[model samples]
Target: MKLYTWLSAPNPRRALIFVAEKAIDIDIEEASDPDNPGQLSKRYCEKYPHRRVPLLELDDGDWIAEAAAVCKYLEALYPDNPLFGRNAKEAALIEMWDRLAEWEGLMAVSEVFRNTHRLFVGRGLAGYDIQIPQISELAERGKLRLGRFFNKIDERLDQNEYLAGDIFSFADITALCAIDFSLSRKLIIPENCCNVKRWYQAVSERPSAIG
Candidate 1:
């Protein structure tokens, strides 16, 4: 399998952490910049219709998009050192929060990045610039939720080293990436969020985090 990636994207970082955690060695291909028109060129778009990075191209020629799905596939492939949950209840809870973290947490953070970030210059067009009244309202609500999310995760981590359970699941990596991205993209919890800050430090120190 070959994984297409980008250097600085948070979405790809999700897969990066997963593969690193599992110590899975797969062929890596760097995707051309999304900002560059070449991304949508015939060759790349054929390999990945979404025209996004972090694509997993299976040897059979099937392509897997989305970071979570890629993580799930990797977890299934290498179960000795697991990242997803182990059992039924564990799986449900872990996936639930993972979905929430990706949807509510990461999505909102990404909006702040793509829309508010200056690097998006020519890219932040129609879909990127469009304002949803709900997200705008939620952006305010998200500020409070961000605190709650941090507080909840921090409290959880206080008891166990990882989020979801004693194990370090993808949820931890997802939350970690989201929180780190928030520093540059959206409203970050100030240093006063002691537990959150402490938890982030731990996550940051992980060897996989460098990926």
Candidate 2:
């Protein structure tokens, strides 16, 4: 198996965290994509039609795209670690919160970072090129939504060590990547989220967080 990875991107970081937690070893190929050639290239698109980073090219010539799907495949292949959960119902709960974090939390951050950050003008996954300055109003609008989700997550964390289940799961990994990515954009946890702060500290202390 081979992983197409990007160190600075949250989506690929999600898979990296999972591989670390599960202790799975797979060959990694860094796809720079600076010239937009990586995505538009016929070679990569033949196996991965979408041509996104974080794609897994299996030895059998099957292509698995998307961060969540790649992680899910890894979890299934390595069942002892059980990041997704032990059973269907337990897995569903983790999936519920994980999806929420990905959509409401990570997506909003990506919108701001991709459109507003000058560094991503042509280097982004969408293969977009050109200078696009930060739109304070647009970014703040997304920030408000992210703020609400963060508060809700903080409240939930106050009641449990993990987000969806008793054990560390996918939701924890996804949320952690999102929080860590905030360092690039200077997004900090608000002062009033005591519970969230506590949870973040705990996650920071984990050995896998050394990345």
Using TM-score, give the best candidate's number.
2
What tens digits encode model 1's per-residue C-alpha lDDT throughout 27-111? Answer: 9877764566323334665556676667899989898888889879877888878777779998887888787777666676765
The regions of model 1 sitting more than 4 angstroms off are 34-42, 121-148, 158-160
Q: Scored by CA lDDT, what does every candidate get?
A: 0.72, 0.77
Model 2, span 38-114: residue lDDT tens: 33444555556565668898899888888899999888788888989888898999999899988878877876676
**Model 1 Cα displacement at 177 (Å)?**
0.9
Output candidate 1 Cα RMSD: 3.7
Clashing pairs in 2: none
Clashing pairs in 1: none
| Displacement of the residue 125 alpha carbon in candidate 2, Å | 7.0
The candidate that wins on lDDT is: 2
Q: In candidate 1, how many clashes are counted?
A: 0
